[model samples]
Target: MSETIAPALLAPATSCGVFIIATPDRLAALQQLVAASGARLLGAVTPGNAAARLADQISLDLLLFDASSLAAGEAADVAIALAGSMAGRDCRIVTLLDVASIDAVAGPMFDAGATLLCNPSPTELAAALAGALAPGGTRLHDAAREREAERLRLLNEEVARLAEVLSQLAADPANGVRDRSSGYRGEPLAEPDPDPRAVRSTIRARRLRDQHFAPELFADPAWDMLLDLYAARLEGRRVSVSSLCIAAAVPPTTALRWIGTMHDAGLFGREPDPTDKRRAHITLTDRAAAAMRGYFRAAERAGLVPA
Candidate 1:
């Protein structure tokens, strides 16, 4: 991330100092101050129009005016332009000079949208900048939105590429998740189909459900009973625990106990039907979706179709 997840702590709300037409010595001092208090020392604007270039390159949090060498009019003009560039920012403009320059530089600079700090030390300067630049809700949210937008752009390109490659296969049909590289590189041409028998277990039986094997899964009455009841309740539009029992031809008390066990195992949650206060429904948790996918894959292999 360009910005830090955990933000650097700036002190409570205050204005950031403006550095207008900073000298090398002034820049070094500000950098030291920034490091000390973990505040962004904002922009170091050059004299006149040149400050805009430096500001654009560096996303600083404050500015400072060096009045030690500049005329009052010169310093004030630069401060006004800098304020114009960062018009909405809470910038503090502190003029660095001997006490004589107070009348010469400080008042005009402040009047042009800068805050005056009288002879601030490095620590005080840093604290001032941090407090001024600490993010409010809008900046953080904008940063987050930018990050997500970049991620989605990359993901979309990757998916599109995969789709293109698959389309080139299957005679370029617009359907199916085809394997483009399959049936190539000198592979064998497979044999004829065998008649169905007890050995002909569905693909579901070969799938693993946790540590347990799938063929052995339905040996538990609760497992088979749940599946049959689930399908029936869905088909019959009776989407509730009581309906599941009736659909499965099982006793309500027994079915409820099994469902309770599954729910406790993090397999589902009970939600009231949106349009019916008298009834509630169980929805599969994500783990339960995996379980259902395995079951459906098996049914597909056995050529099972909805009645």
Candidate 2:
């Protein structure tokens, strides 16, 4: 029912290798899908057998795990095993799950360093396979992990520097203090009045342009979601996860994954609704808000946007 499919590269090529790990009932359909993509089967195996094959140093360009047929802890275990075995390789792991089980399986799949595709149609499956088998497709996980690691390293350094500054300020109140109650350097700092309506209007215009010209040009939904949340915060409105997903304009599964990643990166926070335990509100974290403000300020200075 979900229209979101695995993103594909423009040119189609033969798949080098594909391995499917699933129960017997799921294997036939998966095999047909893989075969249709012109990929080498490499033999479909049960989860246990798949683990053995991975241990035997069998190389795979794409690994598909049927999460619907997996037991409670099986998918995670398999993912971890695959990740460990395929370390430093450009293998892409994909987990297939039913729509109803997406929320439940998503965490484990991601933790295992696998992409989640919820109930993809045959067309979607073929596209995903082709993309995974494409040249350089295997580097997707490695690139993402490296980026995240570098970001964390920088954030940690910044936190330490800020802590030292705070400690010094606490120790000596007037050491680096400046009197700015009236003015700085004898000139009053004028606060720029920003029109919230204009900001919203700019975002809406950009969204329209993107939708009309190149809706799929930007694959990363984090920035889009961040902009939406920033605008909503300015309007004194709260965003629910479902609403944010719609704002992402991607598949719900993909959008949800981005949300989780953003939350992990300290760019978003989740607050529970007092009236309903089942629903949670999403808001930009202080750091994310500061980052967005800095981005807007830079854009304004560049004359890309009206100040």
Candidate 3:
């Protein structure tokens, strides 16, 4: 990687968010889409309310909405109105119609400037998001970027936790994060393990279990490189949500929404950014690292990260 090309891991941080609106059948899948892809759920709105309603509440990306079993005019009307509204802010409006309803609205929908998505899935959502964001410049979400982001996220969440205990011990000599860095070899770190007692504890480190992330696990799906971006800068004390978003290859608004989710999950606790009056920073809470550990173990086991 060229120095000018700052890999996703070293990219600047930024924030971003996304919205989904669909009927009952697609709701769960959409939520799952948000989780797997790192996008935010502004809220789920009904088809009736998609046009003249809830437009003010969320900025939707790929609005995979329903038009099945409705009059062609009605479906196109709603899509047109929403597309107009979405265009006001340059937001992308994507319409998802069943195969049966495609003919009714396909032409008009596309003519109205709506990107059409059919039978969407996690892959489709991720693809659509990547295409729309095209975030490669600072933080790419290509396979390599995704894996790196997830790995760095896990590393950050894990190391901070382990390091905190070390920091406390370094300050007082009693606590630690069960130092397993040593067992994981060829690591850029570990030989510099200053705390012997803590370092020893990790040699036979046990795998962390029940590694499920709380709701925040899905924060800012659009900023797929967030973890890498944030982790890359922790040493410099730049943990602000806005900075992290930029690093993570996300827009500011998107980053804030994800930060809120992490805050709710306790991965991020409330700590206003000192340098920026209008923005706030995210400090990895103690459990936050533990939450990320499970992912690290899984990624390493799967050969996704450097085991």
Candidate 4:
């Protein structure tokens, strides 16, 4: 890899410094990435070097681990050790793994308390750095939140437009309107309920069917995963990490990455199973649950569903 830093990542880092612990193969790339982000590179951690020594000695804002260079177990051990050494500090851990190893490494890394990126491009690398450096590690920036809000706004508008068209079609009986006299007429349909529970049930059913038909077709599993958690929360139910992956309607590796992202974004929380150290359950954070409720309220007020 080249030693040169990308111009796009050249923006100066915040006051908190960034560091990397990579094998020799990944050192140059990680160095360039850190330099491009305008953060100080303390040094690289090699096999012979003590990861604990460096972690304890330095004041770091972020630690980037090269998972491709290390086995999943090794990476998790290093991450967990570093996390322990840096306990009470604001340092965040980010691991970089190849696309193929993502599934095997993601859960272990997160269980060890680290965020991750899978075969990230330069742009993604920069964005990940920005997010890690941001306050609370819950968001990238105001601009990102604005973009998300805009997307939701657009979706609502589209739904409203489609609803209006359907209403028009219903009112205009000339468009394939069936005669009641031709068959046994059923009772008039009830008004659509705006209750979020109803919507959640419908979405859950659709997700189940999608899982059966084409699980990998979902373009944004993270958002869908959040919706699933929100629905589960509303129904007083708990979902395991494995179950959430199934709900995501994607491969386990892809779903794992999304779960990690959502957890980092402070939208999800994890609770270890008391009897099983290897198992954990994931749930929505209070903030995320509140946001979901607000969204449902807005949708109802917009007449997207019945009040």
Candidate 5:
């Protein structure tokens, strides 16, 4: 592996500095992207040595890591190192990965609040770099870029709405969402927990819609993930971040964004794997679980099926 330090990096006062850790095959393209983003390419290093090298370069404004070529174990190590080293720093992180690498790499990256891209196009790469170096490069200069930005904006808005609703439903005692384990007002609720099979059947029905219609028309990552986690909770199973991403049936990046949003909204919580530090499982918070149960119970009472 070769490492190059651009001369511009020697004079940090002039340009935004970017450090890259990518595989040999992707190094050149990533360099080209960094250059195109108008950020100074501070240096390029291999994944194995990235953490040690990164620790020495504290002035870097961005860190770009491509984990597509790495084995799962190696990717996990690099992810953890990067997350630790960049904590509380002003630097932004952009991680490029494929579906295969997501299970190993997404957990740490998600924890670090890095932008994760799964098999993105060249345009997407350029846009991400520009977004990372925003305020100066935030103008939507093209139709495609504008559309993409609009999509992201809408996604955030929708998730925010869902989060607010979930919070309200779970907290409002009048909504019949009181603690199920203990009787509410010394009176036990007669409603039983929704059958896991019913939730699973709804999931299958949603997937079946893709067979006859455009899946994009009904791409609801927030709801899909909620149903999945609720069903898993009922089944006494744990859901890894990667497995939940798959359950979303959306792009991995999109799924991850929704997960992060929901987690921040207090609807989701992270549980570290007792056996594996590199992996973490995602779970619905007690509030979220209660809201889901209330929703199902409401649906049953209204003679409406769960969607």
Candidate 6:
């Protein structure tokens, strides 16, 4: 059965109009949130009736699709519907997916510009809803958003610093800076690409450290993923979205967000799988690959093993 907030009780016209496709339990959980976000609940339907329900609505401002309990094929259908319905509009789509169904729907959901949350907790879901709703949306009155912004800012700074150093190394391989003050004098040799095994070994070493110490001490998803993709590139292996998330060594939601961020930053690129239309592979961009190569060459020249 489906339900909707009555038209007479709906919020003002400025309130976002939301349509949902989810199980009864999930629908029940989101009802309060939709209303709290100042988003009028236009309609709610089960996965089986998603297409029919969507067709009846003349317009929508947001589509909240929950695929956590769905099989891969059904989830893919929902993703396709989301993309098709909002093709040229400003409708915001937020999809909830579990680990099992992520590989099937992630590619299409990303292409549709939907915010993908993998097995999100209530807090995470609320944060995502608030962000999507924006100025009119209810605020959480917490520092979580601020903290995330600070973390992302730090991440970008680190990336920029590394890129600058690698660019210099690539541009002038023979020009080695002799830091007499630190007794450091080594020029990065323009050697052949580092062996894929060497990259894999470095990844293993990072993981091994987590066994002895706090994993959070070395929690750097961006660098971890870069190394993973670099190794895959060298080995000519395709990396699925799920695989990359594992390599990130963080929560699935965080990994997905980082993947999106990296993609937007041009550090990552997506390639559609030729054999599987429902799947996509993540790869380091040419620029990112060049930086990785420079890093490895520099490491070798300085007599330090790749880490």
- Models 1 onward score TM values of 0.31, 0.51, 0.36, 0.53, 0.80, 0.81
Ranking by TM-score: 6, 5, 4, 2, 3, 1
Q: Residue by residue across 1-307, what tens digits does model 6's lDDT show?
A: 1343333332333467888889888888787768756788999889889888787888788889999988888787777777787788778889999999888888888878888999876666766776666544543354744555576677667666766777676545555653556676566444457999989999999999999999888887888999999999999999999999999998888788778878877889999889877678999998788778867777877889765
Per-model CA lDDT versus the true structure: 0.44, 0.64, 0.46, 0.63, 0.78, 0.79
Tell me how candidate 5 scores on lDDT: 0.78
Candidate 4 C-alpha error for residue 35, in Å: 2.7
Candidate 5, 1-307: lDDT as tens digits: 1334333222223277899999888899888767656778888999877877987886988899999889888999899999999899988899998887787788888888898888877766666677676544443354643554565566456545555654554455445666556544564333357999989988999999999999999987778998999999999999988789989998887787778777877778988788888888899997677667767766666788766
Q: How far is candidate 2 from the true structure (C-alpha RMSD, Å)?
A: 9.6
Q: Say which candidate scores most in lDDT.
A: 6
Q: Model 5: which residue pairs collide?
A: none
Q: Clash totals for all models, in order?
A: 11, 1, 23, 1, 0, 0
Off by over 4 Å in 1: 1-21, 40-45, 48-50, 54-60, 88-97, 134-307
Give the candidates in order of lDDT, highest first: 6, 5, 2, 4, 3, 1
In the predicted model 2, the residue pairs found to clash are 90-138
Global fold similarity of model 1 (TM-score): 0.31
Taking the tens digit of each residue's C-alpha lDDT, what string does model 3 give over 105-224? 443444345555544443544455545444446434457345645644764566566556444434442333455545753423211212223222222121121145443444334223
3 or 5, greater by lDDT:
5
Task: Please give the range of 10 consecutive residues that has the lowest summed lDDT in model 2.
Answer: 1-10
CA lDDT, candidate 3, residue 187: 24
Query: For model 4, what is the error of residue 101's alpha carbon versus the real structure, in angstroms, after optimal superposition?
Result: 5.8
Q: In candidate 2, residue 106 scores what lDDT?
A: 53
| Model 1 lDDT per residue over 267-304, tens place | 54566556643235655554444344434443455677
lDDT at 258 for candidate 1?
Answer: 47
